[model samples]
Target: MLNLLVIDGVLLFLVTITALAVIEMRNLFAVTMLTGVYSLLMAAVWTNMHAVDVAFTEAAVGAGISTILILGTLVHVGVKERRREKSLNLSALLIVTLTGGALIYGTLDMPAFGDPEAPVQTHRFQKLFDQNVGKVPVTDTHHVEAVAHGAEQHGGEQHGAHEDEFHGHVYNTVTSLLADYRSFDTMFETAVILSAGLSMIMLLRRRSDEEIEAATQRTERVDPDTIKTERMDPKTTQTVRVDSPPGSDSSGADKKLAAEIAEAVDSAEQIQHDAPEETDKGDQV
Candidate 1:
């Protein structure tokens, strides 16, 4: 009993620490890992309490499937939480404190651990179970050795009798309760878990190849780094010449337009020189 208590205490302490670490953690990846660790610790605690079925469920669903789902969610949502200023919310703190106090108070009325006179053990359902299936036999090492010796002496006859005794009945009470007596509840629980898993798969499923290809096509075809844009300065003027293909002949009209443009430029330069000479002649007169 002391050993069980010690183990339970240790597991609970680990669970508490993990929970705190998860709450304090900003990184979603680390928090997801800590959550799985916390679930595993709780599963250990449940197994120590002899609730093996619950422990198995917790380990598989909480630690295994749940961790996988959270990881998938992180892929889409990113693994880092948005940074925000942390502030203590007094209302939330008050609510949590009150809820914890209420839970502790509720447990005060409950029976001690493994108490035979507890409501669960003394309940009508338990009486029915005992009457129908018989209480599970507790066998020690000496009892097991004696049974083995008897089985050897009697051979097939003893083996047949033992089989007949446990026929059509589950030896484990918890298994019997979940599998036989409360089968509908168990079935519904399984359905709920299945639905949840399917929903998660739907939500976290990757895009189809066609959708991915379409998205790729929508992106810019040209690389921004490879593109060069030349911006001309407003203060500078540049003349661009359009060169025809080497074998292409220039039209007569194009040649005539080019000659007229060159003649106009030359005339403008001659008038500038004649103005300077006329000004010098007027000064001499």
Candidate 2:
């Protein structure tokens, strides 16, 4: 019990921290990750509270789908988060808090946990669930391992005789509430997930390499250095045509003469144009 309480307290603390982080984080990706953490903590709390069905749905929808959606958004738009107005939105917060306070006050008359008179674990709740949840046969107690070579398998006919002696309810109420009672909610949730997936595909699907190469070629025409830096072609031992800034002659032939410079450039151009395609390809690379 103490361990459970400690876990619950930790979950509450983490929930608050996630709230603060989501509010304060400048990076949208960090905000999304913190939201996922919040969902995980909530799932843990649901598991601890004996609500296995709720825990499963929370873990799947909140942590799994929510995180995926947020991550998709971050991937396409980048992690930048726009800052909210500096002025406090106090009026809106005050109205919300006041309404919440009123709701909390109304909960004062609610039954305490594990109260004997509470309807949660009673005949009435069972009857209500039975009326709504179309019955499925008791599957969990069907000795799932009985199909394998075992004593139970040998006594398959006897299994029916023993079932009545130790019967368990097949219609779990919480599971029914999630799948049947709120079926539309789950359907809409599925729709939301589909929408997110479609949006991400439409938005973030990267341009093809051919398209990227075309764009790069365009950029290079406007400004050629945008392409890759040149390097020496090892095959033919040719130094690639890498640009050097004016007046910074690394060749050390500057003082030789302007005539020598023009002649060398023309000769180099001629060699480049006349070279075999094999050598030229290596030089381009």
CA lDDT, every prediction?
A: 0.67, 0.62
Superposing every Cα of model 1 onto the true structure, what RMSD results? 25.9
Q: For model 2, what is the error of residue 77's alpha carbon versus the real structure, in angstroms, after optimal superposition?
A: 2.9
Colliding pairs, model 2: none
**Weakest ten-residue segment in model 2 by summed lDDT:** 219-228
Superposed Cα deviation of residue 284, candidate 2 (Å)? 58
Candidate 2 lDDT by residue in tens digits, 1-285: 899988888888888888878887888888888888888888888888887877888889788988997797678789987776764688878998999999989878877865877757674465445643233246634666654555356442323323222123445766555566577897998899799889977877666465566546442222222112222223211222244332223232322333344455577678777875525345442
Q: Stretches of candidate 1 above 4 Å error?
A: 85-87, 128-168, 201-285
lDDT tens readout by residue for model 1, 157-261: 333332223443666777767776677999998999899879967976655565456446643322111111112321211221233321132344334434554
lDDT agreement of model 2 with the native: 0.62
Candidate 1 residue 257 Cα shift, in angstroms, is: 49
